[model samples]
Target: MAFDFDLFVIGGGSGGVRAARTAAATGAKVAVAEESRMGGTCVIRGCVPKKLMVFASEFGAEAALARDYGWSAEPGEFDWKRFQTHLKGELDRLEEVYRSLLKQSDVTIHDSRARVTGPQEVALADGTTVTAKTILVATGGRPVRPDIACSDLGIVSDDIFGLKTLPKSILIIGGGYIACEFACILNGLGVEVTQYYRGAQILRGFDDEARGLVAEAMRERGINLHLGTNIVEMARAEDRWEGPVPTASDAAMSQALKGAASPLARREGGAHRPGEAGPIWVKGTNGQQDVYDQVLFATGRTPNTEGMGLQDVGVKVNRRGAIEVDAYSQTAVPSIYAIGDVTDRIQLTPVAIREGMAFTETVFKNNPTAPDHELVASAVFTQPELGTVGMTEEQAREQEPVEIYCTSFRPMRSAFAGRPDRVLMKLIVSQASQKVLGCQIVAPGAGEMIQLAGIAVKMGATKEDFDRTVAVHPTISEELVTMKTPMRTA
Candidate 1:
């Protein structure tokens, strides 16, 4: 059956772009429609920009350390305008690179929103209907505010990059990686950060000992973290304050004035407006009432399956609104496929890209491949990062008897500087097979360390295998190999 193209991709995110490019390379005509930027969540807002902020946020601590080392270093005020200008240029360049890559692969770019009109058909925002032999949906998820009154007054994670001036005081709500990471980032950047988590601890579902250390480190770094706390009510400070209320610091006020002419400050909804609205007055479940220059909700993310007409086209979606797909990413409708965050199968960008490749191999190359979702390593970019791979000790013990090898100590750099910071290295080992079931690290460069450790874990390396390797001495990661005894057996 001849159609307009061999493949029609609904989203131009990392997954969709990769699938489109790879499928087009196979001599199949392909086209992609993107309502927004080509890079999607990762390159545009989620990872790239947030990591840059994390990097920018760390200099203050580094400067303090340099002074302790007798380098006579002093941290200066962070210029949000200067950093944001550079960030905007970088994002623009990345978007252009994505467009160029897609064009090089001979894939058509629609540059508009698309919906699945029927089986093997797509309707673009521009009133154009395109039919294809196969359809791929990679529309990623979006950060959503909680269903509470005055929630719209608060900004989501996406709004952070668009903020013209950094708030002097921010009340961050949630305990996930996004919440904790930003709490540390804003705190490091000298914002008065108050974090509230409804859960008993932050970073739920992570290794308990690792998250505990992270929570402690965050408190030591001056983040007012409150566990088992949630916002009961919130309103604009102007409505509650009887007189003039001061929201931000003098420096932040000056920065806001300088950025007043920028469109971002005046933009309505989604983007943060520094001076347009006054401070936010929040009442927590713990009975604490306070005002913050800004309130950030890292509450959660929702898949972008709404209004795509998935159900109308016989594609099944779960209660959470994620498109249901089989092992090879094929949906209930045989010609339709979904990948990345839309599938809700491992929301990591790399995982999404892998799924896209597998989809291309299965449909275009005639070689069926299923993307492996096991033992995926991930990192939380907090002040003291947490890098982890495989099952947590809790999950490992539930399946079989396990041994926990863990250690916490003051690292050389911070200890020398008389800081109370400590790093944690832990391994959850299977007693039956003597295999390293999991590995977790909480320290500087944990992200880099976990990538290498993940390789070993992914290969099903046993404890003896790790023990056989020589330790890289004078390093935090060396503890992974050198720890000879289990702290506890469960």
Candidate 2:
């Protein structure tokens, strides 16, 4: 007899695992395939490990501050090698926990990659296949590498978490949320970090005021900001591009194909690669590339859909390799669906988990519901941290008349801590109805605190509702409640 199941989830990421487990709970047989560990990207590469590193880096600054707080100790150094090992141990434990949970729930764990072989059938990387009543793609996305001349010079978010040692310096090459957070994490830890954005500003999709202010704060922190500039061109040409060693032959070929310069520059103050411990050359846009021990890439994520036979089943994908799905996560091939980063809608971990849950209720339980995505609040665990919910002041003004109220001030703690970093909060309200159109927060723990506002904003809270709430005294969050006059409310 051929074994069959009610649901088969491809890509054992947060969304896929969640959907599988939830479906299994409904007395449906479920099978989940994963080429990597369980726990998905958030657990393995994206958020969890990145945050662990962020927390580790913050201690470097906090140790110095502890003296000001009257606590003193013999200053030690950070061991990047051991930290990586510990992080790996933690991730392994978490992955085991996820696998155990799935097993206890009796969900079949296929230890391989899965692809949509047909409408309701999936082919595993091992060549065997599974046929189910429905298929779910939760493959998630991965970091994208650039096409610079120094192929060895580039790195991505995926490669940073497993770093054996903390870098002395880094150049992050994106303006998106990922790059911004990494710049914060790296710079806060005392690494000389530089950010390169193609536009005149960073955080392109965010509000204008918020974007401008964050850039200022980043600059204040000594983050080398190169705005309105792309990598222009990078090469191993030592004389032109800066580097410590000679260019690898393949690197030279790549540069030649791109028409980049060929004068490989000499090293500055002498540098060596850690592993091979050899002189390696790299070129940067400044025409002055220093020999650094490491490079952390923070560009963007590509949905993990390659080689995962999605199109074989007639599944639709956008130009960016993100799976195409309707509001209910339904694909053109009705029986096969996708959620989370694979769908490329809202690529947050919590959003993926929610979409997974919603999918199970709608399909297996027959509830037929859609995941709520409006006013979804998210945070970036940067040095000051950032939290945001609802629309932005700019986004609100496009539709109708909006009122904008923005405030920038140092929080009370900053006075004592003497940190130049300030808190920024903004609110967008509709002129006709006084409804809160958007909310943006830039401060410590902004991401953690924004969840409360997220609920209210999703429920269609108005600016009046914000006013109704009494201000909590001596707190940074209270600024949201105490907006006096509008800067520009549409």
Candidate 3:
């Protein structure tokens, strides 16, 4: 049988792009199809733009700190339009860079959505079919709304980048990092931010003490943090969305009950038409009712494996739409494979790229490599950032006895300014092996620090190794090496 190319990659995300370029280097023909932009999520929407916003949002606090440091400084009004213009330009440049990389590798770029038609065939959104020796599915995921009434009245994280103007006030729903991070970002940018979480704590699944400090920091910064709270009813005012109301999957869910009796109920309009621009009416779980300029939903994300012909072609898809794949990134059908968020593996960009590299090695280089997911480091860009690598204290104790060393205090810089801001540094070590099992830092620049700390943890550095290393004088990170006693043993 003849094929159009040796490989057909269904997404242009970081994972698919890397795999296509690497596989093409092996003297194999490759083609990548993307329905939207060339750089997919990270470069186009998720990390790149979000990080830029994070940086922009921090300037207000930085300026205030400058004043306290004997420098005349004041935070002026933020011009969101100006910042958004620059953000768009930067994203455009990155997309071009991605296209250049693929072109250099001699890989074909199809600007269309694609799906598996058969074991060796793929169908594009344009009604064109292309056959290949192997097909790789790397389409990532998207934010999902909860099954609540008038949910479409709320926007998802992705919609944040596209907003023309920043709202004066917003109600963010969800306790995850996305919701919490945005709550801080918007508050820093001078928006009145109120967060509602259904759970008892925010940033669930993280170290409890670390998240507690983050929540406290958020509250100190004026974020209205509500725990064990959710929206009971919501609707848009009659005069909203002056332009086109949100539609399709973006529309808020409209339930049958309009004038339902509820303690928290407030009705300022007859009905809501998806995508309209009037103020949003809300009834919260605590019997509080009010109007908000915007309501953002960061509840969760789901894999992008639906309606793309996967199940029709006998490819297995889980209930949540994630494609099931082996350690080698191969699917049940020998010629088909999936990786990145589409597989619901690690859901991180770096992890996805690693999986793609491993797939290239196994399939093209004959190296038979599998991605190493252990000790993966990550950061949350909250007001006071959090960086973590390795196991949590709870997880470590469940596996074996462990020793924990931790510290919390106001750092020198903040202390000098008489600010109440404090930072935390923690280390988890195995009692028997004495090896550093995990490290977590909660403070500004924690993300950058974790990258270096992660290298030591990955090498299985023991407590003695850290003790012998000379400490940098007058630094927060020096605490990592200087902690002499286990605060507690688990």
Q: Which candidate is the best by TM-score?
A: 1
User: Model 1 compared with the native: what TM-score?
Assistant: 0.95
Instruction: Assess each prediction's global lDDT (C-alpha) against the native.
Output: 0.90, 0.77, 0.87
Cα deviation of 19 in candidate 1 (Å)?
0.8
TM-scores for all candidates: the values are: 0.95, 0.89, 0.93
- Report backbone clashes per prediction: 0, 21, 11
- The stretch of ten residues in a row with the least summed lDDT in candidate 1 is 258-267
Residue-by-residue lDDT tens digits, candidate 3, 321-436: 89998889998889998989999988899999999899899999999998998999999999799999998888889999999999999999889999999999999999999999
Residue 212 of model 2 has an lDDT of 80
Off by over 4 Å in 3: 238-276
Backbone clashes counted, model 2: 21
The model with the greatest lDDT is 1
Q: Could you give candidate 1's per-residue lDDT for residues 353-405 as a string of tens digits?
A: 99999999999998999999999999999979999999998899999999999
Runs in model 1 with CA error above 4 Å?
Answer: 248-276
Candidate 1 vs 3: which has more TM-score:
1
Ranking 2 against 3 by TM-score, winner? 3
The residue-by-residue lDDT of candidate 2 on 1-490, one tens digit each, is 3449889888787888889989999999999999888998999987899899788877766776676667874347777788888998999999998999899889999989776777877787888977898888888888877766454455677777655556665667788888988888778766777677777788877877777878888898789888865564443234344434342334453344345545545334333332222222344465534333444556678888888777766887889999889989999999888899988999899899999999999998989989988777887776677778877776778899988888999887766767777888888888898888778988877877688877777788888788889999999989999997898645
